[model samples]
Structure formats: structure tokens, C-alpha cells
Target chain A: MPPLKSAATPVASVLAADARHTVTVVLNGTPRTGQAHPRLLLSDFLRHELGAHGTRVGCEHGVCGACTVRIDGVAQRACLTLAVQADGRRIDTVEGLSQSNQGPTEGRMTALQEAFRRHHALQCGFCTAGILMSLSDYLGRNPKPTEEELRDMLSGHLCRCTGYAGIVRAVMDVTGQAAACDTRSGEAAHV
Target chain B: MKPASFDYLRPATVADALAALAAGGDDARVIAGGQSLMPMLNMRLVQPRLLIDLSRLEELRTLKADSGWLSVGAAVTQAELLSRPTLRDEVPLLAAALPWVGHFQTRNRGTVCGSVAHADPSAEMPLCLVATGGAVVLRNAKRRRTVAAADFFVGPLTTVKAADEIVESVRFPLAAAGSGHAFREVSMRHGDFAITACAATVDGTQASLAVGGVADRPTLRSWPLVGGALLSDLDAALNAFAWDLGGDDDQHATARYRRDLVRRIGRTVLEEALSCRR
Candidate 1:
């Protein structure tokens, strides 16, 4: 662990006033140091500062999972987290999920992406990034999560248009390595 | 929404944190994990002049069990506490209650001490602490003292935590063999704050029950194990307990309804605890 550094000086006196706090975080794979306000939401830092706009912010409060991202490999709502709280931590946005491919696979979409396309999981696509990010983290832990577990894990996310049938199919398809029906479970598949 | 303007101070040590709190006086708010404080700030419910961020103060974020007592740092996050193997083994009631707290996302950022300080009557941690005979350690610039859980809470969202004092840690008595614990609550959703909550601890022939959400503060009751009509006695005691505490009606439920639910849930939890002992 790195030595915790004290603030250089009192930057400002007010809450809305921008006060600078040094935050050293690993965005994607590279370590970056920056000054941010105490009020700067982590989602804004990723979208505006680092230009990783893939991390969406639907509901600024914690109710919506649209701004979900991996902080130290744990799925969290970035909008509800302060930039300063993420100091000296590893953060993985949707951008980090794609970097695993190399050579001929460089810049290629991930297995999850391919599964989403094959299962037609997205419609309007507004909630795809967060849903994918949360599911990626969830599946990483429970690759073979039961149908009930999948439903429970996805409960945090909201998809206004798709009705969640397609998304559930996409997740099941990816995890089951099946094209359709997700035959692993005898329950009738929605999509 | 942006938080109201305030001076920020990240103290590296507990002494420094306490000194900063004393210096800032009543206008200072100590923030740990910032899970609850940040939301309150964004909503402008509290606009303190100075924020004593205790995140860097690692000494105040630990969990240790010894000599039949479990000591927990006030800054320890709900996630951290729930994940600790010792807490899981020794204090499973806390572990069971933690998952019902504000979902995984908030739990990752919310601290155990912060929840206790916030004192949301609907929250799980405070009621668990109260049921386990927990004591909060308070440190001010000059002195330190411990407040028993029963006396710590004064009313809804209020506590005896003084303005100049910071909660350093909380200690809970470890449950002995033949002691069983149970917690249950009802909410609109899994992650939503509880509408009514109850925690019960049964140690041999003695029982301690703490009810939250339906009261201004957690209402507690103690009694010896009765020989006959266990459910009826528990229900009658819970009803009397709620009436004695003067529980009021809120948007969630009527005062009568809350008292009824308390009786129902309290009896259920007590029964569960009793069964676990067998």
C-alpha cells in the first residue's frame, strides 16, 4: 500500500465550491493521478475526465444500476460513490472488459458481447452497458448461477423497453454456452 | 445534486479526527465510508461546516473478538463486517441482517459505525447492536466513554453521540452456546429500508428482544423463559412493549398496524431463536 498523502492546502471553503483532492486510481489498466472535488461523482470522473463514457449515469441516486462499474472487482454504483473515495483503488469500466483480447483478437468484442448479439439482448441499448458490467462481475463469481440467482442478481438493474426477457436469455446463453432455450434448466426459457 | 459547501478534513488518526471534531464544534460531521453522509449531503439534509473524513483512519476500521466480546470499528463497512469470518461464526445475526441493508452497492460503501451514528430506526445494524447488548465507545478531545446500546439511542434518527465526540468503536457480547439469534423485517423491496424490523436473542432461559422501524428508537424488552403459552406471552409482551414506547403511525403503517406487526414479527423471531437452540 502507498503512503496516504495529506491535502496540499485547503482548496475552498464551500460544498459546491470545487475543492481539490488528490486521487490516485488505476483506470482500466493504467495508473492515473488527478485532482477532483469532494463532490465529484465517480461516474463523472470516468465519463468526463478519462473519457470512458461507456459507464452511463441513469439515476444519480443508488436506486438505478445504470452507472454500475467494478471497483476493485466489486460491482458498485459509480454515481453514488465519490471520486476521492476511489483513491489508490482499481476501477474497471466496460472499456477494461474488452482489453483481454490480443493480436487477431485485438479490439474484438468479448464473449459477453457476442452472446448479447446472438441472443438479441439489447433494444434501445440505454441500459446495456451497466447491465453487462453488473452481470460480468456477477457471472465472474457465479458462472453457473441458478435461474433464481440470475434473477436476484439482475434485480438491481432496470430495462424499460426490453422487458428483461432478452437480457436474461443473453445471460443464460452466455453462461450455458448454448444458442437458445438454455436447456441446462428445465424451466421454460422466455427468449 | 451537489452537496452543500463545507470544509473537508481527512484525519489520518483517531486523535486527529477527534481534535478536528472538537475544533469544528457542533457544525462538524464525521464521515466514514460516506455511504450515508454523502447521500444526506446531496439531499441537503445536513450541511456541516467541516467534514471529518475518517476513511484514512485505519485504526478505527477493524473487527476483533476476544474474551466473549466482539469489538468493531465504527468506520467498518457493512460489507467488511458481513464478510468477516469471525463475525459470521460468532455473530451470525449481524451477518444475516447485513444483506438486507440497502443492497450490495450501498453496503460496499456504508460503514457499521456510520449506520449506528445515522440511527435510522429502519436500519438493521442498529437493531442488531441493540439486541446484542452492544456498547458504543465515544472519544472526544479530552475524554473517552462508552454508552450502552439501550441508552445510546434517544429517539428516531437521534442518539446520545455528542457533537464534539466521535464514535471510535462498538463492542458486542459474544453469544454463548444455547444462545440463538434471529432478525426479520418487511420492506417494499429487498433492498429498501425496513418498514418494521425485529431482532431477538435467546440465551438459555433468558431473552432479549429489540424492535425497530415502528418506533422512534429501537424498543427493547427482556424476560425469563416462561413455561407455558410461549407465543401468546411473547405477543402480549411485544404489544405492551410497543404501547409502552408510544410508537406512532407513519406513512408505512398505522400505529396500531405497526404494533400488530411488531407483535407478529417479534413472536416469529423469538420462536425461530428458540427452535435454533434445540
Candidate 2:
């Protein structure tokens, strides 16, 4: 790969305005230090500063779960957390499940990902990472979740696609529980 | 949207936090879970000059079950309280209300006292605090005082907290033996803020009723426990009910509908609590 040619020259004042806080964090097992504005959001810091673009942000007011990430092994809303608040802490974003390992499947695609694939749980792929991260933290504590309980767990996420059928099935299949229904919605069923 | 530039101060002690607040004057805000405050900051609704993070104040992180009450420190997260069996036992109203605070993730970082201090009129913790007759412990450099939850909130998102004072903890008195607690709320979505909610604790012939989202702050009423109140003319009671919190039309619900819902949930929770006592 070669660097793309660009005619735009970089400006310095914008960079100067952002040099307010020196935040150090352990992100996905790596120690990184950078300068950010005191109010830079954790989601923006991950995407812009560390280039972890997999951590998506949809609703910034903390309603949608698209900006979910793990901090100290706890799933949290990146949009609701400030970068300086994350200083001296550990964070895990969707980049942790990126294709980093040599395998037939997506690199670092944990069991939940495989289950999602098996059930055709995702379509637009926008909320996939956040949902996976949210459930990864949730399922660790609730391995034998019931269908009603799993639906309650999934309520935290807002999916405009799939109608949540496959997502529920994937969770049930992974947990060896029975699905409550067989109907799929909107997107063509791939499974 | 991101927050505006501000200094972040992680104070080592409550005293230091108070000093920072005093020095920073009216432009300083405290951050605990940052769940509520961070959202406000992101919306650019609030821009403080300094943020006093109370995450490291060990003295404010205590959760002790005393003889007749439970005191939760300012730094204790909502999830922490939900995880404690004793809180679920002694202050059962809090346990019933904690899950409704927000999603599991928000609860993981949102502080119990912070929620009370943030003072959302429709929030579950404030309703519980008021319904159960809880108290918010306030402290400044000069003195410390405890204010009842009923007297704490001046209006929506407003409280009696001064510039130099910090909400150290919230104390919830234990429910009487054989008392039954019930919580009910109607929201568009499962984890969203309530349209109207009710909390009640009934013991024998006594009952405490508190309703939120129908008023500016949680509207509370205490009276003798009436048998078969759920089966009685709930509509009549709600029709004549005064929403002291000042109900008004909003995007989520109409003022008339909110008042109607208050009566419905109020009757349901009060009846359920009474039945449980039996």
C-alpha cells in the first residue's frame, strides 16, 4: 500500500487548541499516551486518536448502544465517558476483535461472533460491534440466560435491521437454549 | 458532540474535593459515575470551568448496614448497590428501583448519590429516596448536615446543594418488618426514562406513596393503608389528585395522560404492596 496523494495542507492552530489534557490509558492491552482536549469524548479519542474506528457512535446522548466499549472489563457507553475520565484506566473497543490472528474466521472473532454468523444475526453491520461487546460482558456473567432474560439483556441495544430475530437466536443457540420463534424479518435469512 | 474545554480534577479526599469546589466557585461540578454529568456536558447544556472527580475518595466509598438503616456513600455506583444482598434486603425499595435507573452499563459507573444529586424529577433513585424517606448527607468545609429527600429537591434538576458542599452519602431507613415494597413505571422503551412511575412501601396499616414524571419532583403522599385500594375507585382518586410537581405537556406524554397514569400506577403499586404484606 502507498500513501494517497492529497493537496490539502495540515493546519496547526486546531492541533494547538486540542493540547489541553495529557491522557494515558491502557487500550486493548497496549499502553498509549496522547494529548486531547479536556472534554474529548472516549469514543472520539478511540476513533481519532488511536484509529480504533470500529467503536461506532450513533446516538451521542447515551440512548443507543452503538458506542459501547469495555473499560476494566465492564461494558460502558463511550459516548457518555470523557477521554480524560478514561485516563489511568483500561479500555477495550471493537478493534480488539479485529482480524489480528491467523485463522479461517475473522481474527479474534470470539464465540459470540461465530454464533452471530451462524444465526445470520447482522445485516447493516453498524451495531454489530457494540452489541457483541455488550453481550460479551453480559453473557460472561449470565451464561444460562433464559429467552425472556436475554430479550431484557438485548433491550439495551437498538437495531434498525434484522428485527432482532437472528440476534436472539444467535444468543440462544450459543447458550444452548431454545429459540422462542422462527420468524425472521426485513433482511433475507442467510442461515 | 464533545464537551467544551475544562480542567479535570480527581480529588483524593472529600475535603480536597470541597476545597476545589470552593476555589472553583460556581463553575465547578462534581463527577462520579459521569453518567449524568457527562451526558449534559456532551449536549453542551453545561460547561463548567472545572470538574471535581470524586472517584478516588475512599472515605465516600463506604456502604455500611447500621442497626436500623443503610448508608451508601457518594462514590458507590448504582451497580455496586444492586450487587449487595444487604441493600436488597434492608432497603428493598432501592433494590426494586436500581434496575430501572438505566441500563446495566450506565449503572456500572453511575453513582447512587450522584443520581440523587443530579436530581432528575423522573429518575428512579430520587423517587425511591423520597418514597422510603431517605436522606442526603451534605458536607462542606465549615459544617455537615443531613436533609430529607423530601426537602432536597427544589425543582427539576435543582437541589439545595451549595457551591462548597458535596453530597457525601444517602441514608435509607430500613423498612419495618413484614413490610412490602412495590415499584411500577411506564416507559416507551424498557430502559428509557419513565413517563410516569410509582413507588410504595406498605406495612400493616401504614403506607408511603411516591410518584414521579407526573410532577416537577417526585410527588409523595402518606396515608393509612387501605385494603382493596386497587379495586376501589382509582380513577376518582387520580382525577382529584394534585400533581404538586407541576405536570405539563411534553413530547413524551400529555399532562392529562401523565396524571391518569400516576393514578393507575399509584393504585397498582399500593395494592400490590398491601397484598404482599398479607
Candidate 3:
């Protein structure tokens, strides 16, 4: 019989969730392939395996929408999706949004991000990335959304910092429902 | 919490899936949308030797309507199902109930059949199916069968499905014309699970009631919409319900509170539905 593992012996990490499968996903605009465990979450794969830290993981149970990402043009909870399930799919994360929008280096953030900054929609900003990704995708689908529809869409995300008033105003301003500030700063609007 | 190790097998067809499931037997689990299962797995609540991913089974994703029933495939995502305009027009109650099932993210990948199979007491789909008098179609390597939604849910997170069986689809009977329905739930937050919910359908002079989040599963009952008695004496109507509802007290609310809310919310929903009587 094998000797009992000493109290100090660190247990060998719970068998690694069977990492014998290959997953290939087109993340953002680039294609990425990796060997991942069947049980590994897509959020962890993006953050750990691919070093895409912009995709946050919160309430991995799918309640808090901080881990929201776009899979095949649909906003989805990354925490609940397995990396293996994302095989052969297209994924869009907050990092990709940032890269595509040409933030700061181009002397410009995406109109939505700029709106968030201007309207004081973000406080600590922990929930900013996920919220931005969700709204960006939602707006792409619906360029003009009513207040009730916007509230319903915003209900999916939980933001502890901003009470979401400014976020609402920012989206409205971007959609041109209200008077927006200068587009040069990309920062325009108030709740 | 991370999930325990398990082999993932993606089968191309329902037959292949059945074969894989039969081979894996007790060690296998079917994963469609992974909304419910993934959360359970992350919490380490269950660990299986092999997971038969049913994502590739195109046969299980078709949405079709027949003369008697509207069929929703096992792998059809809740969001996808909600997007179908015909479904919205034909099953208004389902359309009203879908938005309350989960937030946009979860619904994007959550499946109606997965929800039926998970059989969560507070989940919206099973309760909707049960109230709408729907049925669940199940299959195994040997045969296929159907079970009424009311009978399909054995208990919380429990069902009658055998280890080797699969939930093929759910068939909800098309609502008869001139039916007005309403759904409401009391949750701590907008997207959180319901503390208590009420769904009511007004079909002619008949009213069907279903109260969820107050028991191990949604409690259903029906009454004649006679002379506005149900509307006027709502509390008595609720009390009169054969609430064979097995309720318990937990962090959210007490059984007594649930019973009270059932009356209040049930009344509100019934009133709302009947007010907009088709």
C-alpha cells in the first residue's frame, strides 16, 4: 500500500480535468489553437493560456456578468463556457475591443469607452471591461434602443461602482438620442 | 471552483450520441448548453468519467411547429428560441416567461431542454412547460418516449431520466387563440433566481395558475374564471388551491412567507392576465 500523504504534502492538483483535447478558436480577429482540459473554462483559457487578462472572471457561476464575452456575435458568459466547447468558434473579448478601437495610442478610445470615461460611468472599473464588451455587441445589433430595452439589457451586468445612470446616458449619447459632447474627445454625455 | 477531469466526446448525431451514452453508461453525462451543468461542475457537485457533448447533434436543434404542439429541440438555446417570431406570436406566455429565465448572457447558451433536464425548482422553462401542459421527449439507444412536464420533474435537480437516456426535445402545445398570459417573479435582484414567482393564463373562462420558487417545483392549478370570483376573492382562491406544494424555509424566505406571497403574486398575475383578456 502507498504510504499516506503527509499533512504537509501538497496534493497533486486534482488531476487537471483531462487535458487531452485540442481547441481552436478565432479570438478577436486572430486564430488561436491550444490543448486544454475538457473542464477548463473558456475564461481561464483566455486569461491563462492565451494571456488575455482583459477578460475578467467574476461569479464564475454566471450570475455576475463581469466575464461576459462575445461568441459568434452573441453576448455570452465566458465563465460558464468550457474552452473545449469554444472549439471552432469565434470569440470576442474586451481586449479585442480595445485593440480594434485603437485606444489612447491612436489618441482615441472607442466611442463607448470614451462615453464611459466622460459620463463617470466607471468608478473602480473592475466591471468596465465586461460591461463595455456586452454593450458594444448589443449596440452593434441594436443601434437605437429604447430606455426599457436598454435597462433590460443592462440588467444582465452588475456594476457596484457606477449606479448605471451614467452608462445609460453614455449609450444614449452615443446613439445620438441626446446631445453628445465633441466626437474628437469621444467623451460626451450626461445622465 | 474548477471542474473535475473528464473526457469530452462530441457525437455528430442523436444515434451516435445514444451509442456513446450507452457505452459510457453510469459514467457519462450529456452537456448541451452547459449553463446549468457547468455551474454544477465548477462547484464540484458532480464528477463524471466521460461527458458526451451534444452540441454537434444538429438533429436536436431544430425548432418546428405541428398541428398540436410546438417542438423545441434539446440543444436549442433559450435566446435562439426566443428570437423566433412565430414562437413569440404562437406562444405569448413562453415569450413573456423567457426573459425572466436568466440574463442575456446565460440565455445565450442556456437551452430549454437543458433547463427541463436540470429541473431547477425556480427555473422558468420547466415551470412554463408544466403550466402550459407541455411534454418532454426522451430517448435512449433502445427507444424513445414522452413524459408530461408535470411528471418529468421528480424533485429539485432531479428527473426520471435514466442514466443512459437523453432529453431529445420538449413539445409545448400551441396556445389556443384568445389566450392572455402574464408572468411575474420576486427576486432579490433583477437577474437573480426568483424568491417567488407567479404565471397565469386566461383561456376563455378558464384560468391556469402556476406558482414557482415556493416549492421544490412549480405548483400548478386551474379554475374557472367564473363571475370574477378568482379576481375578487384572490386570497381565498389561492387558499383554495390544492397547493400540494412542498415548501421549505431557507435564506430567501420562509414557507409561511412563500405561502403568503403565492397568494399576493398569484392574485397580481391573474389580475394582470385577465385584465388583458384576449
- Counted clashes in each candidate structure: 4, 1, 1
Runs in model 2 with CA error above 4 Å?
A1-18, A98-108, A179-191, B226-238, B242-246
**Best of the two (2, 3) by TM-score:** 3
| Candidate 1 C-alpha lDDT tens digits along A63-169 | 77888888877788887777776777788888877786878888888988876766667778878888888877778767887777677667777788877776777
Which of candidates 1 and 3 reaches a greater TM-score? 3
Kindly report the docking quality category of candidate 2: acceptable
The candidate 1 chain B region of ten consecutive residues with least summed lDDT is B226-235
Best by DockQ: 1
Candidate 1: which pairs clash? A14-B5, A14-B6, A15-B5, A15-B6
Q: How many Å off is the CA of B112 in candidate 2?
A: 1.1
lDDT at residue B3 of model 1 (Cα atoms) = 70
- Cα lDDT tens digits, model 2, A1-191, are 12111101111111222366666777777777777786788899889988889999998878788999998788889998877667767788777765434466546677667778767789898998889888878888889888787877677788999889888888887787754333343243456
Fraction of the true interface contacts (Cα pairs closer than 8 Å across chains) found in each model: 0.18, 0.46, 0.59
- Model 2, position A28, has a per-residue lDDT of 73
> Candidate 3: DockQ?
0.31
lDDT ranking, best first: 3, 2, 1
* TM accuracy, model 3: 0.90
lDDT of 2 by residue, B48-138 (tens): 8887878757788999988877999999999889989776678888888888888887887889999999889889999998998899999
| Candidate 1 TM-score on chain B | 0.94
DockQ, model 2, C-alpha based? 0.28
